[model samples]
Target: MELLRSLAAALAVGVLIGIERGWRQREAADGSRVSGLRTFGLLGLAGGLASHMPESLAAVIGLAVTASLVLGYRSEQARTASLSITNTLVGIITFALGYMAGQGLVSETLAVAAVTTLILTLRQQSHAMLKGMSHKEVESIATVDYR
Candidate 1:
């Protein structure tokens, strides 16, 4: 079925991102992460299912997902005292990617997922490159408005 395919694509997106996240946090304790492979997969599926609903209902589901992600981040922040929000941001993005899959843009969705996963995988390389760059260069990059 079409819905099944979309959900499967969504799961694939989540699993792709989740692989990176899981590997990144491999050194951390077993269950301390805000989200890892399983949670992201479920979130992806949830997004796909939500997308099948009415517009207003989908919006409500999105809100619930956002709220849950924020709360999970908050809890993990309290435990780890980590100010970094990269994982939370990625989780949110994974949801959006799922929504894209649900929209039947399978090829485009996979492309975006690949790009996002590449970015996620390049964190260390990105930071290392920044070390050689001047402040203005970094500032310009940081301040550039894509909009």
Candidate 2:
């Protein structure tokens, strides 16, 4: 029963985050370079599966996911990407941890899910704010000028 509960919570969290990502992907004008709803959902599910497995295996799975995210980010950076896609990946891992902490059968995972969803949902607004800033303003903050 406890295991079932944890799985449900994890699944719910994954789905919630996935929905937000999906919405953002659909609305994005320039389109996102990151994996969206389905990918996020699967990642969360995989995390949950890892968490339920033996400790060593779970650690391996987590490490693999982290490594993949790092490699993906590095690849994107090499291509001069703007938005960081790793946030979704991080959210999935964190959500899995939260589910594990919640022990799979409580509202605690919901709270975690809410926070993750909020971040994913607000990404566009955050990007817009960054985009709206002037190069001079950024340079002033950084105390360095390109020119």
Per-residue lDDT of model 1, residues 21-68, tens digit only? 888888887666557788788777777887898989989988988898
Best by TM-score, which number?
Answer: 1
List runs of model 2 lying over 4 Å from the truth: 27-33, 83-95, 98-102, 124-147
TM-score of every candidate: 0.90, 0.67
Q: Which ten contiguous residues of candidate 2 have the minimum total lDDT?
A: 97-106
Which residue runs of candidate 1 sit more than 4 Å off their true CA positions? 136-147
List per-prediction Cα lDDT, in the order shown. Answer: 0.86, 0.67
Per-residue lDDT tens digits of candidate 2, residues 59-125?
A: 7877777777677777767776647665536654654654363355447667767876787677779
Instruction: Output candidate 1 Cα RMSD.
Output: 2.8
Q: Candidate 2: global Cα-lDDT? A: 0.67
**What local lDDT score does residue 30 receive in model 1, on the 0 to 100 scale?**
68
TM-score of 1: 0.90
